[model samples]
Target chain A: MSTTRLARTGGPRPAAAAGRGRSLWRTVRASGWSYAYLAPFVVLTAAFVVYPIFASLGYTFYDWDGIGEPSDFVGLANFKQVATDGYFWRALGNSALYTLVLVPVQLVLALVLALVLNNPRLRGSTFYRALYFLPAITSIAIVGIVLKLMLANFGDAVSKPFLKLGLTDEPLQFLGSPHLSMWTVIAIGIWNTLGYNMIYFLAGLQTIPKDQYEAAQIDGAGRFAQFVHVTIPGLRNVGLVIVFLAIVGSLQVFDLVMVLTGGGPFYSSDVITTYIYREAFGQVGTGVAVEPHIGLASAASFLFGLLLLVVTSGQMLAIRRLRARKEGK
Target chain B: MTELKGARARRGLTHLVLLAIGFAYVYPFLWAVGSSLKTKIDFLDGGLGLLPSRPVWENYAQAWREASFGTYFVNTLVISVTTVAFTLLFTAMAGYALARHTFPGKKIILGVILATYLLPHGYTIVPIYDLINSLGLLNTLTSVILAQVGGGLVFGTFMFMAYFSTLPRELEEAARVDGAGFNTLFFRVMLPVSKPMMATLGLFTFISSWNNFFLPLVFTLGRPELRTVGVGLYAFTNQTTTDWTLLCAGAVISLAPIVVVFVVAQRYIVEAIAGAVKA
Candidate 1:
């Protein structure tokens, strides 16, 4: 890329021309090739990622049935409806609960597991890793089916026995009840992600050199004290990355939730993405199925996308602040 | 006597916890596998044991035949293999570009790739559908392939770039002096030397593509013929809610490729993840 630019600019000092010209021609040739190489990614992203983001914004203002017709430009009406919408609020709340609950619990569990598994004396370490990380790679399709069976109600092979044995009056309608469905979604999300994030924590744990622990030990610090005094502080960046990233990821959650409960017996389990899908594809308005409210769905998606951007940017800013405080330049 | 007693108590407790947790993880898999083998009554019975009295291997055949999964199997295999190969080539090339070249726009390009992953595909599904449909490519294997190639390329590029940034540059420089062009040097020198990175990257790409649930879901749009394994598996269960034996068999069958990859490339995958952590 540079070679082409250099050649286009025409010359250098006369003495260095022969050598530098070859370099310039080479640079120009490489530049042409570089753009050619990079073109496909650029085109795909522009077509797919970049255009969709902008189109989503444009779509938010218009009532267009997904299949056909000229879109009706509805102005800010769709956005206003979302502001007072009950189901929209519930979806937002469920999504928030996932972020607020699942991310923290998952992070803590991951940290503790990483610490335990990072123990140099630990045996069967590889086996433990494979066991734990299996879910990270396991199909969420299969996860949904297995978890559904485990979490089923009456006549369920597993849950029925527990209910029969007087575990509870009735098996908890996990996917049915509005109250439990969100938490169930959150729990599954956490389980799906725990291994991948824990590996990051383990990495962070490894970076806290043996010397720091040795230093603390020499100073008569106990293991727990050393963990608090050194390890927690040491993992700040990794924590920020995992936690912030987890929040963004959890908000984007779709597949397993869709599988476990088609946004539920009620609208209880509805999340932004599921809500978007339902609006676009399912009961659109109030009659048989809801009328396809493409505008409302688009508006909700934009708001949801904005919420993610704000949270991530906030975390990034906090990270910068933390780093500044540490360096104190 | 006291020290020994304390040691034994702690050991017992540790093993007990491991055993309990082990059961939680292992039982689901066993149950899934077990369900595939059982008759409808036994499956419904949900016995504590994984063993099937009859051990019906015919469920596998039935599932394979019933779902028309053989067609989807070919679709999936083609998509995954081709996607992985294309992902491998492009990502490595791009990774090499970003890693070796002190080029303008490198950082910006990397940032764009990373950010693409962050934006949920759920948000982009509509326009991508629109875009694909406009091109009259709806429900084509190419649409699924393109969706994956597009989606998978971002992370694949990022991961490879992360690994490649640390690769030794001395060889590239020497190859340049040997009067080699960029292609020859990359092919003969740097590419050959990036064996470990290529393996792990390929494993990573294949696994993601193999198990990708979403891309094919929306793009397939009810086309039975064009579905990949993941979406095809979904269609199987959705259509036949009662016949879970066949469904579970399909589940096990779909997972076979990934399990094989994991077994073979287990060590490299671990080290690569571990290496990323340290970096």
Candidate 2:
């Protein structure tokens, strides 16, 4: 079917002998099939992913309500507004703080879990693995709601233990206090993501051959020394992937924050995505409905997206350089 | 003999530590399930104890009736099923083409997909919203389905590509020599051999679609009847924030399908994650 279509569409061709022409026809036929396979995916991705990316980039340079077309072309005004806006910087800082605190804690805990459970001799390792990973399956939105309730001012779930330990005399408003809210969110972030990260590390751990450890033992190396030498290097790639994912994922944290704090208690816990939400849709209960400013939201997100692209690209470049230097040594 | 005893002791210590950590990890979920059966007063008064002095199963009935979870269930099912079906087929086809064929512009196609892979959903939400609005597809399940599948296709293709690349080329060569067409070769031969990858991709697409919050939230803003379970529970909690018992019941209701899918296909889920990151 496509072979005839290819022949019909052969507008330009290189002059060649009969044998070469046959092979060229064969090449065209093969490409026709490949194009058929690729057509649906390329079309859909262009419609949604590629086109929307450039569309949003174009939106950043204009001032438009979300409903209609961009009438006013305001060059750099929206970008300047977002850059100087106090809330935007605050939200960005909060997101960075969360990532800073959340990534190491999550990675370390997950690595430790994987190391402990990587033992083939351990009984019920599957059960433990499944148990640890249970939270990953639950929707983060539900997790946020449940965590919010558990940490409520009068709720005894989180407060009772702290009270018994005499950590605080009063039942602390974990979600209500501005200072404590972000920390609570960060803690929940680690909890919700711990299992998934552990799975990554576990997969990484499995790929390291047991012979390496045996060789280290033959050389009279201790467990800690072998781990430092062999395990770390073996896991370096997986660790980089995990860390990059954790950073990007935490940077865009929204659903949990939406359901949990709603950037509450004087907007102390607003992250970048939530800030963008407010810019686009306005705050939920601010008496009068604020106008939806799609242009400003697009600008903020565009800047944020650029930052993400640069950070990720930089990370990849750094990793590649490190690997090359290590190989050279 | 002493080394053997020492190794046993170390293993015991490890198990003890793991058990304690695992308990802490899973306790919140257990507590939520326990709280659902308690009365409001009982739950507040019972503190950390998981046992309910009064077991009230009616909470499930009430949450189902009041929250319209039945409607949400069907709505989410339709969205998730259609999205997963389209995502699996489209991505698999793309993956097969990329892996098994040589073509002009192939590098550019792969580059485009990879670029889109790194583009986070946060930046695209506004334009996607505008795109949906312009197309007059807002507030419809189809809009969410289209967006979700498009978003998922890249990673799915990545996974399938990795899997397909590892397969030996001889089988395909033999089939091609026997006059098998491309479609027949893929569906009859390659698809059967690629079951594990398909399972991994399908489970992932299903779970993410089922648990998806942002797209569904933004798309179906005012359409309560068309809300997915995630958004339905969110709305329920917003309306009844203090009713812990009812909220827990609603949470349990929403979690059931995903929990079942996870328990059934958990190995593939983990493999999918591992393969995705590695690929």
Candidate 3:
């Protein structure tokens, strides 16, 4: 029935290549096991991960509820609305405010902890290391829900202390107050991630070579001076990677935000991810759930994803250039 | 003598700070463990204490039965193990090929694999799921395992390829010269040499597959029978007025395997990560 069989019986089916047919089959037979190993990865990735990007991007250009063939081309309409939309700006503002406050404070806290733990003479070093790294392996959904409960359960833990110290007259509802939700989200991230980042810092610390630290000490360098002159400079690339990663991770912040705030306390904590999810996955609230806005959500997703990719890639390039210039590469 | 005195003062301050941080870090874990033993009233009784007066170790068993997590645990283990197994097989073979073989189009294929690593996992979710569903794999362990394999391979391939690039090719060539062929050289010779790297990759992949949340969440349809520990653990806390004891119990059971892995494999982890960094 097939050309290959016909060719075998009738002298190459047209005299093109009688010998090549068997060679190709033979080649396949030999590497069949390799293909067996590779099939799962390739099939899953090509179908699930790679295809979604193209599909979602295509969805951005069409108005389809994902249940019908009556798709309408709403060219760039979602993008236009998202750009001009007040809610979009507010969402961006919340993320920016969160990051601005969170990153520096978290970094300082982690760095201080790292410097303290870098003491070679410390007892229970391994136990302390494991403790610090604990939160990192927990699932985001669990962390999100647990942190929310803790905040709610012990509102006085944060609010009463701040208020008792005269920081504010009113107790802040960290997750309930629109003003405080984003900061609390940031705090959750820092708690979960500090150890992972600290490990990165520790690795960078190793590259400094203990001899340099000894030399600095011999030259009458204070601990602060050694850190300022040697440790900080030594950590530049790792810092760059950490900063870039944190920025990217911040942009992709969705699961925790969804579980904890649901982009709420008045839609004040909504970012692109939660906004996209709500649009695409029917936000249920206040006695009614809306239908999916597949087209609009897809458009917004593309814009957000593209912006994130560009920012992260740019940061990576800048870091490489800085590294090269310093290394005289 | 002045230097010694200053060093002593700084060391004392460092020790104090380290001790404080160590307390903060360890306290939450202790609280989680302690609270899991408390009754609902006991949990509501106080903010945080070292241990409960009445330890209800049965909460772990009760939570297990309530969620029917016994079934889900087996499902997760199967999917995770399958994923790690496949990822190691394919990524290593492909990595070995890319790193050692001077084949045509090798650079282009390797480049493509590297590029895929930069794209966020979320980007491909729709297409991949659609394909799986089209193939009648929706809600199947195979589908989840497949997704994990893909996600893990990108990193696994990169790490292994980087590792193989550092290995000596002469040994392999000598085997090849002896008419050993590709399969024999790869399996009989090259693989035996990279046992440590493979073990490291296995540990990394196993932990990642165990901790995977998003893939299971998206694919498993919240079917209590199909969820991984990462997704299933949220059942306790997704509701308002979460029972802290039950929640902590679930968290403990969920994290146990990973903690054990971390504790047992610390030496290999440190070595692998340290090697990865320097390379």
Candidate 4:
């Protein structure tokens, strides 16, 4: 009887082990289809998105001019060159300045407009929303092109009255003078993207329950008091997000700046992006031939990316701290 | 009575301010359209005046011929359409896989994909440009489309994955119970049901692809004939002495399709942004 029991137990044990093995194989076979679905995205992303990043990182350590293989491994020399470059710092500062001036002004304007448009009693609000949102949809490059042409051609015409009225002796060079170029770009940038933020703020407004405003009204809050107490608090989360997006977006300003200023008049309005473009592709429209520096440009790009990462993380940390404090209170 | 009068006046003042700002906001495009229809002299001398003394309709034809915008338009359409197709196909398949199936290495794959979102897109162009050059695909529409698709996959896949996750489990169970295979379940069952998500993503992809300048510019640097409208227009402006009217006409041509797309799909576009932000 004992011998019989041992035989039976051993028999089931091998069968159970085999069954488990079969099930695992079944799972892997089932997952074969899943991997097939993921293949194209994986392959393309690996080749295009993920690979280029590492490739660029590799390029940053060399001094190659984008032709043939990068042979000269300079070992952080490119990074040092970028760090010491005056033009690099200028470009970085200009980008920071653009974000600083743009975020507050754009957000405040967008919020004010959103409040006006969000009023349920407002007539033709949809029309006004579409009207304001027009520039945001249009291509920034095309917008820059048209504006550049208009300012170049009719700038004198528009400024003629000012000139005649002795507002200024010379015709205002909207894009020519270095002092006015960055401001001009910023003004156009605001106009170009104001509608997007307005829409965002409007969306935020939609999330604020109608009863809260009514509650505030019943508590004897006037219009300004209600805005200060209710709307501001309601918009806090979305406001942080909008601020973050605007800052990041402004820092990456490329197409518009390229079309509008080409970072011209001795790189006065040059953002980091334009600076990188100049290094990678040479001076595009200035009839000047400068050798393309793939290594240097890649180094600059990685450095700028690092800086952006630091800034964004700092912003996130501050936001978290603020939220924690509020919750703690 | 005084309160009612004051309220009416306040409403009127608000309308006035909005109207004025709205006009200033749209005045650039209006000015461009008006200038496109103006004679060279009218355009030069018109000064802030929107209406041309006499509309010159031939400027469009002239700009079309001179800048070869016809070729550029066709190129842009082909590139944009192809990019959207590949993007939708790859992202949808991948998103479905990620959402529905529990597979080995899924977490690692997801981690790798998410890690890419942190990389700033600005500096990577050098390597991408070089990659295209080495592949011997430089100055071709294929290169442009490939780069656009590759660069855009992360966002599309993420969006699609989120969308697919929200779908009911019974969808797959029903398909499987009906003896439907994996491909049939995805293509016939799941993809058809995800029409709204597709539309939202497809429209955005189309708009961005149409307006894209940098990739097209860099990839097609050696071949101007293959340049898209955005790059072509930039090139047009770079001529030493530009015809302002023709430039304006070119701008209008580039802006027309997008403006129409926006006007027609504004509701979807707005809703998509709101939805994305909420998510």
Against the native complex, each candidate's DockQ, computed on alpha carbons, is: 0.41, 0.55, 0.28, 0.51
Give lDDT tens digits, candidate 3, residues B1-279.
Answer: 999999889877766776787677656566777878988888778666657879988888877887656666777789878877888888788777656644223455667676677765444454455566677788888888877786667677777778777887578668766878667877898788888778988888888788777678767863668877767766545555556778878766776777788878766765565454344
TM-score of chain B alone in model 3: 0.89
* Candidate topping TM-score: 4
What are the per-residue Cα lDDT tens digits for candidate 4 across B1-279? Answer: 999999889999999999999998999999999999999788767977899998899999988887788888899999999999999999999999887766656788899887886555546898888888888999899999999999889999998998998988788777777888878989999999999989999999999999999999898888889988899899999988888888888889998999999999989998887766554
Number of clashing residue pairs, candidate 2: 0
| Clash-forming residue pairs, model 3 | A47-B127, A47-B128, A48-B128, A49-B124, A52-B127
Residue lDDT tens for model 1, A1-329: 35423333434423475687676455546565555666776676678777888888887788877777436888998899988999999888888887889888998888878887787766776677777777777677656766665466222444566688897676666666777777777877877778778777877888787898899999999989998999998888777777777788788877787777767758778888888887766642123466677778888888887887788778868888988998996
What tens-digit string does per-residue lDDT give for candidate 2 at A74-106? 999999999899999999999999999999999
Give each model's whole-structure lDDT: 0.74, 0.84, 0.71, 0.87
Question: Which regions of candidate 1 are displaced past 4 Å?
Answer: A1-30, A153-167, A283-291, B1-5, B102-122, B162-165, B274-279
Error of 2 at B136 (Å): 1.1
**DockQ computed for model 3 against the true two-chain complex using alpha carbons:** 0.28
Q: Write the per-residue lDDT of candidate 1 for residues B1-279, one digit (tens) a residue.
A: 999899778866765676677667656677778888999888766555577888998898887787776777788899888888887887777776666654445557877776776555447677777778888898887887787777666766677677766766666667777888767866898788888778887887788888777777777766888877767766665552547777778777777777777767777776677665454
User: lDDT per residue, candidate 2, B1-279, as tens digits?
Assistant: 999999999989988988998998988788788988999889878776788998999998987887687788889999999998999899889999888776657779888877777656557898888878888999999999999988778888887887888888787778877889888988998999998777777877888898899999999986889899889878776663447788888888888888888788777787767665665
Positional deviation of A271 in candidate 1, in angstroms?
0.9
Predicted candidate 3 versus true structure: per-residue lDDT over A1-329, tens digit per residue: 13223322433223338766675565456445445445555565565456677787777777766555427988888788778988777877776766666667777777766666666786666666667776775556665665676677777765877998899998789999988887788888778777766666666676777888889999999988998988998888777777777677777776778778888878878877777766775674333476877777777777777877797679868988997899895
CAPRI-style class, candidate 3: acceptable
Pairs that collide, model 4: none
Model 2 residue B249 lDDT? 88
